[model samples]
Target: MANTWNTDNAGVSALASGDFDGDGHDDLALGECREIADENIDDPCGPEEFAKGGGIHVHYGNATPGSFGYRQQTLNQDTVGVAGVAETGDRFGAALAVADIDNDGRDDLIAGAPGEAIGTRAGAGAATLLFGGPTGLVDAWGEGHSVGYQQDTPRVPGVAEAADAFGAAVATGDYNHDGKADVAIGSPGENAGSGGVWLLPRASVNGSSAFTPAKLGLPSPSSALAYGRYLSSQ
Candidate 1:
């Protein structure tokens, strides 16, 4: 299959990237969904919906051609024959973050899947974590691999407490500096109308041939914090 260089799909909304494998390779992350640009296409993204619903997908690579492969890793509402999953719809990975939590030398992903929104077709979203391994991605559904996610209502009190809506996410550095990585999200347009932020700190990554993904939110201080408050770069 031909590899896609620039990840700009009409079927894909937002695109995010980072070294998800800790292999020193920055992987291309995409959030699939439809757009609701008022009165049309060719509109400028002055911070508005661009695309709309599929799911989230990631491709590893560099800027030059052939730096990446056709292979990919993905997560959706559909269960891979697993149980205890409440099944979701039209939900897609609105944002993505990747890091090497636990410093096990492997990378992992954190995705934001917002649900449907009012006054628009956009989703409100949730979060996801996918672990990496030697062969590639150690996804939850596949064989010889294991996966987990943040418990519902994980908690980000001050971030978007009054918002009731979780938006895009961006992963930062290993907060505790344990040599691992972490996750962060931004919730713009809250109830009070300003905006908020949320973060997820990855704890134990790999153990016993399994990949466990944990999530923690940033402590939302009552006063205003920095935008991208908990976000960091390589």
Candidate 2:
């Protein structure tokens, strides 16, 4: 059987799959990282609108073979369940990670918007966590739906600088051996271009509280190291 899925504006820049609905069938998340200015005329985004941002789409699975059906959800900064306002250059779905972060027997989602700017700190980057609910992934920001997190030099305890490009990469694992999964966010533009990574504990994430992450970096004095450019859990 041949199954195909499609989205507008050359979507599907990134892809990840898991049992997002807890129904035994796997679901897919597609990252549409570029927003087209005009679909009718195919107009390109102007310099001022470079930060118009993009979005992610979740396709729920069905019992039918090779079918996701029409049950789907769209997510972005502007989405009802998402936290924070959608801003230009956020690239909300640039990178994705899925796992049972809360030990709820349901898969959760993590999306990296490495282009997201914080205050005057352009490209400071951000990430969003969407928890799965009884029916499936919560479609909007609410009591149990979504939370946004970011890495800053002050709170994350690392090299201080702007345009750090945090959230450029993400990974989850039991870094503390606590049985619960933890997240590691990579900032490839930190330390005057040396890069760094921050580890967020599972407890902190589950509690939905502010946390001071443990930063990691290389021992060398090399510039432009980009240590956390990519990450994975063993």
Candidate 3:
């Protein structure tokens, strides 16, 4: 028999409802991903950034107030588009998180991706960042590709790829004072292309729900991706 039971968010996706706004009524803090991409692999590029990897359709779900994965939808134009990060070019978008890392009283999200990467698309490729706006979650930042220092360095959202990516993230704290939450991305490897993580502090960020796609300027090896969970649990 196949094992199928997970109490924690690890190894599985979930959602719930609560007062993320700290308001009397409940709010929405959800995790969305391309659990299933409804469209065909148009193959934006000949070789394609996802050329070698298996194509993964986009899958996304929404939360009910404080509930994570409370409500999900798998339809084109239903929600945000590809994070645009090169790493995630090949049908990526599965990892996701929703927590109040910034402590803005309202809940926020942190996306994770291991396979998300861009091919040699140059300017045509960029990174991806979708922020929550007056409407809902929307593709709000970065293009969809990593270049120069950003490449080999998955830590930063700039020039990084949220595509075909995988890994994990944990809430640290609101390093900034933007009434939002903060999070850190991981790239379990070593220095010099070994991979790294990105630190996203909350900002007064508002508008089309776009993020600048930044990298945490931590010391070299900001901290390996494998042992990143220590901060999330503690």
Candidate 4:
């Protein structure tokens, strides 16, 4: 038998599956990258409320097909485990990636908000890590041992800049030959559209101190290359 899950939004922009709760049953992550506007008001929102970000919904799997049960939880910038507040144009769920980023047995979640604005940098973009725990995905800064990180946090590197689109894309692998997994984030709007990528080592994500990220950029003399527009790892 087949089953269907639906959201209020018309377009379900992205999808990812994994054992997010470590129950051995596969779970699904759905990204709704567009905001649903209230039609009642002609100008429903102000500048900061327009396109007020999107959301990531997690549906835990069941032993029986077509009976996966209701959505376990909904995730967004304002979610307790998430690192930031939902903002206009953040598009928080534009991209999604899953891995055991903290080297824990349970898989964690990475969400990309390419339109996220940092400070005064509108559309600078951001990404967040929602660590898994005994009770399933928990807050990064909440109590009871949930590992978490955000692009704007000191624990990670780099700040959001205007039009950086920092979380345009994301991928994971053991880039340093370490047993733990690492993350690579794409910023296609950097350097006057030349673009760039930031490598966040597993150590850095799991560490407490601030660190600089290892950045990749197009070679000199190349303008508007947008090198890190997309990324992948072996």
Candidate 5:
């Protein structure tokens, strides 16, 4: 019988793919950004009390060719090794990007939780970086193997403000011609509707530092442009 999973209003909100296991066949990552859940482990997917409490499902590819029918895993803030806590409106998997940030031959996953609160700033938005390894996605790093990015993070531009939506969209590339990958994050709801994009270097992905797009000489957009409503990179 074919494997099946179900949830109401927990539709696939985002997607990305990579050979997470280095098995040559590409794997799949699906985001159910509208998923609802609570702290009740007894009834993990219930009550609808935590709307927009998103999650992701990963399916490693099989040898069948052109299929991703291998083992499956579900992840969310509440997952034992994942970072953060599941809260109403956090929308953890609303956006996703894939890249070999560390150039370790394994592609990493970048997730956006546009409704996350930064400190006391509700809806300030945030991004989570999950690394991949020979054994598939692994959280071997001390900080749950997951690193978070937000407006208020040290060296990251801007302050954490309500509705900033920093993780509303995401994309990745080697912007500086560096062998490692860089990331671009969108805050379409920033600056009272004047959206902005932030570019984080590969070093940042490895727990080093951050850099805004402007520092790379990208011109800023006009007021209210909502520049990062959608973003892309090679």
Candidate 6:
């Protein structure tokens, strides 16, 4: 709870809740999509930090209603075991989703950085996966923990294009009627601004290899639709 408020332009732009510690009480994840970094453990938002690098803060819950535990941790690309680098406009926590992606009973976290650059393509977008463990969120899963996915990634479909904004929104569900959860990433700027959604099944995610994805309900180019701008799951 220390240093929770600062002048770092750390906007709480996104949020998710789950039993990340397996402690029965649901924990909260707050996304500061416009955060800049000082990396000062005592004060991340101190004067030294100023830019839109983005980050997420986890607040473990207490047994008492509307209460959080003493433990709090903030995550960003700079954190050990996390993927990518904390850069201006990465916006790492612009969108977030929680699910038992590995089907290991513990719910995992998926964070979207819609403004991330891919290769030389600015704003090509990306998403990061973090596993949930007994202690809390960890990037320790052998196969796919703390992995970053973009259009040109091995298992992910499509080509990396500028201003695609692929991770503008995110959601999870059993899209293929499988027992494990699948991920859907939104690219609101894809295909000349028509927008697109990519569906990655559990098997594809587990394999960490190239696989074809179902492009959910796409509208024609002339329709001028941003089809994947927002998403939610039951």
Q: Pick by lDDT: which candidate is best?
A: 5
User: 59-110 in candidate 1: lDDT tens per residue?
Assistant: 7675565565445655444435211132344344555555655456766555
The candidate that achieves the highest TM-score relative to the unseen native structure: 6
> Model 3: residues >4 Å from true position, as ranges?
1-82, 85-94, 99-106, 120-129, 138-167, 170-172, 175-180, 190-195, 203-225, 229-234
The sequence of per-residue lDDT tens digits that candidate 5 reaches over residues 1-234 is 011122234456677888766767678877644433444333322224323377766778988978774565566787656677887788887888888777777777888888898778888998888877776774433123567888777878778899888888887877777666788888987877677788888738333333334444556654566657676657
TM-score of each: 0.55, 0.77, 0.42, 0.74, 0.78, 0.80
Q: Which ten residues in a row are the worst by lDDT in model 1?
A: 206-215
What's the residue-level lDDT of 159 in candidate 1? Answer: 26
lDDT of 2 by residue, 1-234 (tens): 011232344544556676776787877777644545455543222122323576766778888877773476666777666766678777777777777877777788777787888887788887788888766665434333787777543344443346777777777777777777787777787766667777778725333322122233335565687767776643
lDDT measured at residue 66 in model 6 versus the true structure, 0 to 100: 87
Could you tell me the lDDT of residue 57 within candidate 6? 76
Please provide, for model 3 over 1-234, each residue's C-alpha lDDT reduced to its tens digit, 9 standing for 90 to 100. Answer: 001111243212322232333333433322222222324643211222232322222222334333433322221111225344333333222233445443435433344334444455221211123333322342224111111222334444434333312233333344454544554444443232334444555422222121211244444444333333222411
The all-Cα superposition gives candidate 6 an RMSD in Å to the true structure of: 6.0
Candidate 4 Cα errors over 4 Å, as ranges? 1-10, 33-51, 66-71, 138-159, 203-221
Residue 57 CA displacement from its true place in model 1, Å: 2.5
Candidates in order have lDDT scores of 0.45, 0.65, 0.32, 0.62, 0.70, 0.70
lDDT of 5 at 124: 90
Ranking by lDDT: 5, 6, 2, 4, 1, 3
The positional error of residue 65 in candidate 4, measured at the CA in angstroms, is: 3.9
Please say which candidate is ahead in TM-score: 1 or 6.
6
Q: Mind giving the per-residue lDDT tens digits that candidate 6 earns over 151-234?
A: 888756678899989888877777777666787888888777777787777625444322222244333333346657787854
Deviating ranges (above 4 Å) for candidate 2: 1-10, 35-51, 139-144, 152-155, 203-219
